[model samples]
Target: MATIASQIILHPVVSQGLKFGGTTLGRDKTYRALQYFSRFFAWYLINKGDKIEAARWSALKAHLGTARKLMRLGKPMEHLQAALRAAFSSSPALETITTIARQLGYFGYLSYDAIVWASTIKLINVTKETAARVQKRAFQFWVAGIAFSLIHGALKSLRLAKESKALKASKTWGEKDLAEEASRETRVAQITAARNSNNAQLALDIFDVWIPASGAGLVNLSEGTLGIAGLISSLLGAKAQWQSVNGKK
Candidate 1:
């Protein structure tokens, strides 16, 4: 205890987010918040042995700047709390498009906004995984579809299953799935059924949340891509109608 007190009282100045590395725990609220925020990111952006992003990270920067002004004048930074609140409104990295934003959002945080930022990245990165899974599943379905197209409509259910994976997982033709021809007969059948269906795209639950994803720019979603696209269209249509009738947006 004596050693800790001596360090804070006699040691060199510590930066805002620095850990003293000794046994003394800093009991400041701001310090705690910074500590918690730092936990989410395992790595941070640095340039030439110094962190590059600070104020320009996210809208959080705006909040922190305001707080600093309050601290400087000896006036109660009552709005510091508010700034903290606002800074947490989005992921620092994905939303801000700055180095600080990216650094802050490197790891998941307890803050909802921070999580929102990190989760979006997770979703995007996991998108490839989902796509790969779906492609494999699609291959299986396509083969089944071809095998059973001449037989019972049992494949309709299988096709539906593959489409479900695709829509929900946002699965697509990832590299591994595309390495060789989808040798699965069921997958071919599934694709064929989709092409044959009057409303093949009906099976997908498309998230209205649009992002500026990189690829062939904005391919038009085709109804024939998945079987019974029209069915999903109808269900969504009905849901919209219900929402309208119930006054629920």
Candidate 2:
């Protein structure tokens, strides 16, 4: 039977719902909620042993601006996929990596909101007050989003590399040693799972206690509340999976 994590990753209703609800709330809230949920969703997919899907999903989420630009430029989205595949090849050449990185750089430069704001200023007349505050906010949003994407990608890559190295090292052990190592790893995993369960319970408890005090101060309380609830739900779901793995009730 498929695991709950697998079901969630494959269906993605929870993530999609959060995105839709967040967008309805406000642009700022939408991206904030999305940035958080993407991390959670990526974790869920990885837990389900769908690391490739997780990576692709992470890439897509990080490159929405690139997607938008592809639409504007009449380029197919598959082009980016091909570029990424080539860039990530086991024996990728320096030129291939450079090309992909350059493309990403160009996309970031052209589609960034700061550049868009400047273009808008040149093409359309607006009050000075509107230009100063509103456009500046737009520029900030784009820069922050790009920075977040870079950091997220870098961290995920590092984690994957470490895991790969560990797996490769394990392969060098003899059969008996490998079996013993696997058993040891399994026990450690169980302890880790139990710890995760405790952490999740603590998080849910704190969220429940804090919601009443914090909810009143939030702008767009209903939407914000939904976003928070969604985040808590995902945490609880992961906790449940960990508990199940560890044979905990």
Candidate 3:
């Protein structure tokens, strides 16, 4: 909601040492400009690209550039910082610009999608291979989001239907066992259906994108990224196995 400049100023302090894309940043006098640059990239990707991830990265680069410039110029610009801050605050159009400036930390602010795209953009202008990897990773992130969303929706729907039936029968049911008996078929059905539909490949698609890359990066869970994509894959693979067993019943 805040303007670009305000986001730059406010975010660094408020963001609380968030990290991703191989950078450590903050709201201190030094980190302010870089904050704006990253935010600008977020703003750009959010609006310009057909994909939400692309636009977000664009916005991030924009604000980060601005904030970085200001940080470099750091002479005696308390007044200038104040002015820039106010300009964004007064202008409604600068809303997205401002929000991007505030910056986001990995575990704290950056979402899974933003983190993936940002990593990809870091690949840009770096090397052909890196760019390719970034693109691949971003794609996997999208697929993961979509896959999770569909399954999540289905699960929620099943839950609501069960709850509604229980409520409707609340007054008439004498035994708790009756309620359990009534819901048993639906639960079994939902779980069985989910398990049957679960493909190990489908569940682990996102993880596959990162496994080779993680190996190439040489992190091996030692540093940089916690290899989030890899972690997700491992968990999903385990779930798929669990689902297979459940589906048999």
Best by TM-score: 3
The predicted structure with the larger TM-score, 1 or 2, is 2
lDDT by residue for model 3 over 1-249, one digit each (tens)? 469878886684343323221132222322333333334344444455545675554455455534443333332244245435645564333432322232211111113334334444463244666646554553443343344434444454455566556655653444767776677656666655644453444456434434433433522542113234444554554444433433432
Q: How do the predictions measure up, each by TM-score?
A: 0.14, 0.24, 0.25
Q: Global CA lDDT of candidate 3, please?
A: 0.42
**Candidate order by TM-score, highest to lowest?**
3, 2, 1
Residue-wise lDDT of candidate 2 within 109-146, one digit each (tens)? 33444434444436556677665555445434333333
Question: Judged by lDDT against the true structure, how good is candidate 2?
Answer: 0.48
**Poorest 10 consecutive residues of model 3 by lDDT?**
101-110
Q: What TM-score number comes out for model 2?
A: 0.24
List candidate 3 segments past 4 Å from native: 1-126, 172-249
lDDT ranking of the models: 2, 3, 1
**Candidate 1 local accuracy as lDDT?**
0.34
